[model samples]
Target: MKKTLFCAATAAMAIVSSPAMAQEAGDIQLKVVGTFVSPDGGIEEVVVDGVGLPAGTDTAANDNFVPTIAVEYFVSKNFSIETIAGTTQHDVDAVSGLPAGTEVVSNALLLPATFTAKAHFDLGGVKPYVGAGGAYFIWLRDSAGGGIVPLGATDADLSNELGFVLQAGVDIPVNDSGFGVTLDAKRYFIDTTLQVRAGDTLVLETDHKLDPWVLSAGVSYRF
Candidate 1:
């Protein structure tokens, strides 16, 4: 699975760099963005219900900070396809006394490639835009060893997921090369889950849902 994700990512980059694709670059716009994001996790816990072990329970309110960068190619001045990539680290703290004093930290790489339909409103020095599109998420990782242990003691698995990206931003013209500063914010609506295997102990199983947010700011060069 890891190999396949890398290969797919490489192929996508290749296509973007190809001559034919380059020629289709049309309204090429490049931006470097800083994202302020929030991540929420839905976790399950294993408990002994006075007879045997009870099923996992669901919990939320897990939060974290993350950042990202985005590059977009305008199909027109108002329509575009953008690829936003970033990294996120989440720490799940200990709760109750069940698996108390345990922490699970998950570090993941995110690639959300989306197709957007936007309308740009040029307000002199500020070019603001609004858009919406579908996004694909790739390359995710989860790590343990904080204070909590996964049920089966397995690692984190984040398969590719399909979601939607909604965005709004403004561009400030800088120089003669159409170079400028840009501020953009976007939200990714994704339903993601983490799973752990039960090696020899039927005492624990790991599974949870994660839905995250993405925000950013950067420089832009329009040709």
Candidate 2:
């Protein structure tokens, strides 16, 4: 009778530890998503100018929708590292400074290079994750907006900056074959400096707050 009990316990342990029970250690997940980027273009403080900035000076960046792709590598069943590929474009407008609703930046294209480490929790078939990571915002191209051009602005340049992000998301598997749907959100703490020049003379310089909320929903395939 004791021998029978030992055999049963061994079999139970094997079943619990089998690869079929959960995601393996080296799983890779690819997610194709559509992302929404919204940024708060509030001027933190004017960095450089001949005269002082107007009181209550502020700005707002328009929202953008772009396509993004993410690749994730599982370090273990519960831990993973992820990187993303995408770019977004925005038009910054003056809200309180200058004329209200005036465009300060025509089209500023941005590339956010990101890498994150995530921890996941499996609740039934739903996997929820939280991640933290580093990001560098690269300004690909930009031009003077309508309002700035009339104000003697001949060229516009935004500085590249580094920042970090906090992330949260959920993955719901459609079936057991590594196909799923994912919903994710990330909040970035970052800022950039805008420099306006007219004939080599710095006409306006301002520090802008670009704290953007990135939201995404998409399909996931793990292998």
Candidate 3:
């Protein structure tokens, strides 16, 4: 009876350890992502001279793109944590409605850091995952315009903002220690104030609602 009991216990242990071994072999992955932004909203009006008169100059929001680098660590076969660091650029108006047809462009760089909890599923050689997380965005730039102004106005008022992120993508295996590609998207629900006050008087004061969309595709590595 003792010999029979020992054999049964060993069989049960083998059955339990099989899945753990498979999970340990597929627990870590690293990915790189590139995101593109489409500027489909908002309009800006500009003045040609200091006459406080509208020169009928108008410009469209046409500049926004970001690059993201992330590392994903799998806690188990189906769950992981991912952190990302990247930079984004925002472009402003050129000259519109000018008699000589003057054009102006401005840009700003932003550092967006995010953390996410992800759930991964493997189907044969294909793995798909979905994630949700919080993001903190920092806008950095004083004056990033591409025009000449004698007044020398080069100061911007932007602050750090908070938002939520959601992503879903597929992973295709390459080799033993393989690489995969993913396409992901995110949106930020944010509103901030941008002001340009040269002196005690206000030149520009308005609230900007900056809700941006990111579409990206990148390669990933699994360990």
By how many angstroms RMSD does model 1 differ from the true structure?
10.7
Residue-wise C-alpha lDDT for candidate 2, range 68-107, written one tens digit per residue: 9999999999999999999999999988856798888989
What would the per-residue lDDT of candidate 3 be over residues 37-89, giving only the tens digit for each residue?
65422333231234242455444445455567878787877888888777876
Model 1: ten consecutive residues of lowest lDDT? 16-25
lDDT of 3: 0.56
Choose 2 or 3, whichever is better by lDDT.
Answer: 2
Error at 53, model 1, angstroms: 8.3
Candidate 3 lDDT trough over 10 residues, lowest sum = 12-21
Best by the lDDT measure: 2
TM-score of 3: 0.68
Candidate 2: TM-score?
Answer: 0.88
Query: Predictions ranked by TM-score, top down?
Result: 2, 3, 1
Clashes of 1: 10
Off by over 4 Å in 1: 1-25, 44-67, 94-101, 150-152, 200-209
**lDDT at 74, model 2:** 97
